[model samples]
Target chain A: MGIVATSFRDELLAAGLLVPLGADGLYGRAAAFEDVVDALARLIVSLGAADGAARIRFPPIEPRSVFDRTDYLRSFPDLTGAVVTFRGDDAGHARLLAAADTGDDWTELLEPADAMLCPAVCHPLYPTLTGTLPAGGATYDLQGWCFRHEPSVDPARMQAFRQHEIVYVGDAAGARAHRDRWVERGTELLADLGLDVEAVVANDPFFGRVGRMLATNQRDQELKIELVVTVASADQPTAVVSSNCHEDHFGAAFGINTAEGDVAHSACVGFGLERVTLALLRRHGLDVERWPSTVRDRLWP
Target chain B: MTDDVIRAVLAEHGRLAVDVAALDPDADLYQVGLTSHASVNVMLALEDSFDFEFPEQMLRKRTFESIAAIRAVVDGLTRAEVD
Candidate 1:
């Protein structure tokens, strides 16, 4: 399937999602669009931070072992492009160059002996809450620059994106409630922002043989919902936010048990901060005050 | 699981959603929408909901075929645990 990209990059640039990183695509400064990003992040976290959920922060890069244990590696291994330490002397580089000169792929040189990828969301963080002891469950207000090697360049589905999630672990009822409540609450919040959005059954982009079964189970369970908005196109709305309830998988793996006794089930309300900003820009003009009166009223100081 | 259950279980991948059980047992899992990534997800879900760890040797392909096949594996593991 091919995407009708249709100036999506230009639209986001016009909307202040990008700044000229340079001719090389390695780096570009983020626009002051962050002013809005910070606000959006705050709003999402605040909504998720309710009910006995104590907040925690974690380093951006979670370990490979951690991911492997969670089956995150099994599910979306393709998305995992990682950082590696090359203690190679100059001779090693020369050998790699020679191999490349023979018109072979670059896989030979880029092997990472020890490595990690920035997580897609708070998936890595959920499992870590295991060992911590708490009177109640722990809730985290988390934000990170997550990286995924997605083939879609829809501007909404960026290769590198910002995600903020409110993660909760402990109490199965609380976990399901967190996921169930947010499905309604999140849609209302987005509606208040003045964007017409769709909530649909969605699932993780698991790869390979197991992906089919996973997708079926996902649709069967209706475990995920995509909050979508039509930014540049009416037919193809972008998913700006999501809510997921990951029963007790992470709690069991992390050994995060409840104070009341039992395996802790967990849930997360994850927002693609950048995706929401783009949706906002698509609905209203880039100028803050020029947006719909309702939105402006909600956003104003 | 019965044919209806199998078809429903395999259908969410979009291809097999119609009548996976009608197909022959040897039909490739990928042909029926059991993508490699989704396969891992299904495995994780099985482990989670059933509270059973997957066997290491059975982690290879050719295992996740028809609904009956999955049930056989799940049952064998289940029966073993119960015993």
Candidate 2:
């Protein structure tokens, strides 16, 4: 007897919904798979169209200098990925080739590139929004590929994924309201798409001992909240959406001030595009055509 | 005393907007603009100055909320080291 696909990841691969590319947490999506993702992206844009957010699409990587200025490295050094390239002379290239020929680690020859793989879709936007805001501050509608170094076998936990985010920069009260409203809206949106969704307090995967305190502080302060759905199993659910209040962190770092002269406060609601698509697949089955009429209409219309 | 050492460490690394010496011991470090990023540096410096590593349980924000709080933790760790 052959092996039965028990895990959602295995089922996804077996159904040709996901194509393995010889790496954990990395895969190529089938056209149908990509179609679902596209539909979800469009749905998010349509939902937020009334807000008049300035739409911006960013490259997958951001400047290392800008990235270093942020606290991402201090908090999540383990999960941050930076781009490295060969910036050496011919002699160094020859040595690299020799090392590669012998199956030795040749990556030591590569130097740090000017960029780091963007960990969040909103990360690159802060630097551009420096200086004081005009009137009610700014809001942005953004979508971009984000990279994290967490390689996992869970299909929903892709290392490279697309994020659709609506970010607002304004006063502290406005920031909290933005995050709170999204927590409600995101949960409702996912539930409308035919997924059993729940909102819960969450924390980032901070690094080291000091990070524990940071994580605790973040949770205590209710800085982050995630919209979770059971994609794989009831025991292990995935966060498909996250609403975060940065609360002057980015304002202080980027020197963005409010119109009233105090430091600006910021918040963002992010949708994990791939994870939401995966949850739909897991809940409704691999075939999008056979999904419930209500779900199909919500996604397609 | 640990109080003076804590004061000096805060002056050098707390990155607070206020003068460390003039600030009250019970005043909130965060209220004075000691960011989480700066707090990590202060934690490291405290570890170095006292020659004792803080246990994981003592790594909460409360452990470093104020000069008095930091002094209490430092004294506890040093006393444990001595015992």
Candidate 3:
């Protein structure tokens, strides 16, 4: 919305990293963007290798039943997107065709599918870990395309995005330590990539009245820490990475437990791939060849 | 009074369920239903009402936890502007 943001959007469009669709928020990423994203994913894995996390890849769509258990609707009802399909018979098909001909709301013929687009990478993993943990607990590396219904003109904010996460499931102390360590590690990682970034205490964008209390409680408890970079605007930095301590929220909800039969505490560190790419382009211009040698070596080498 | 002004801003921009007047000076604005989205609106309104922008250091949760805290920060920033 600011002058800097407009120019940055134009830069992204011209660089082939982002292909702007006719719609406001939807944009197609070129190979250059995907190249950066893949390189960053490798960097994340290399950085996390010492932790020995079990690698898992999830589909973009999650089971609706599993998603319902997370109660995301209660907190972020506005951002959830459901997958729908046309499950109609002959009469329904005829009506749908009529609506399409009339240029009316043809989507009314579509019914809800068994799955919904995953809002976060960790949602499906929780259901998979629904039993006792091994010894001191477990750690996982997950990557997936995540969807949120938030549409914005800022290139930093996308309706659909990719997230790479390192998740820890264990005791409270272990989870907290994991979050703290990653908060520091993530800051150093971004700095290594030659971008100006800051780590700040933040809250989720919860919805409505009850959500206010939840957000305040989250901040008061120091549950979320975000690494923000100035991509769209200098005044309002966008969060490129977030380290969240869910405590026992997910563990209890999904019945995940420690070897001692106690509810496990959970923590996750997620890197927003597209956002980080945008930040790099914003900082070093669109041409990767012109970027600082140190940054090029770190990412490309 | 600052409390009156604070209450007016909350009433106009916040989605509170309780009466603004009945709230204690130290009452937690978030606990009484001031969402993060609405907090931004409240912050902008407060800046307009008092004619001073909040510094980055004053943008934390503690700064707007209560009417008293908001008043303290506003008074401090406005006083600094005068000096």
* C-alpha RMSD by candidate, in order: 10.0, 2.6, 9.3
Q: Rank the candidates by lDDT, best first.
A: 2, 3, 1
True contacts kept of 1: 0.09
- Model 2 residue-pair collision total: 0
Q: How far is candidate 2 from the true structure (C-alpha RMSD, Å)?
A: 2.6
Per-residue lDDT of A71-182 in model 3, one digit per residue for the tens? 8887899999999999989999999999999999999889999899999998999998899999888888999999998887788888989999999999878899999999
Per residue, candidate 2 scores C-alpha lDDT tens digits across A166-250 of: 9999898988988998898898889898889988999988998878877877887789999999887777688999999987888
- Sorting all predicted structures by DockQ, with the top scorer first, yields 2, 1, 3
lDDT of 2: 0.88
Candidate 1 per-residue lDDT, tens place, A1-301, comes to: 1244447666556555576343312224355567778878767766766654455555667677776667767668888867765456799888778888998864657656454767666756755566654655777777887877774546566667678877777786787777878778779888989989789889787676566556655666677888888865678777888888776667766787888767677788888887788788777876665787788666654
For residues B1-83, write the lDDT of model 3, one tens digit per residue: 87799889988887676888888999989788675545767877898999888876565667778999999998898899999
Ranking by TM-score: 2, 3, 1
After superposition, which runs of candidate 1 have C-alpha atoms over 4 Å from their true positions? A1-4, A14-16, A20-32, A93-107, A132-136, B1-83
For candidate 1, give the DockQ. Answer: 0.09
- The per-model lDDT (C-alpha) reads 0.68, 0.88, 0.87
Better of 2 and 3 by DockQ: 2
In terms of lDDT, the best-performing candidate is 2
True contacts kept of 2: 0.55
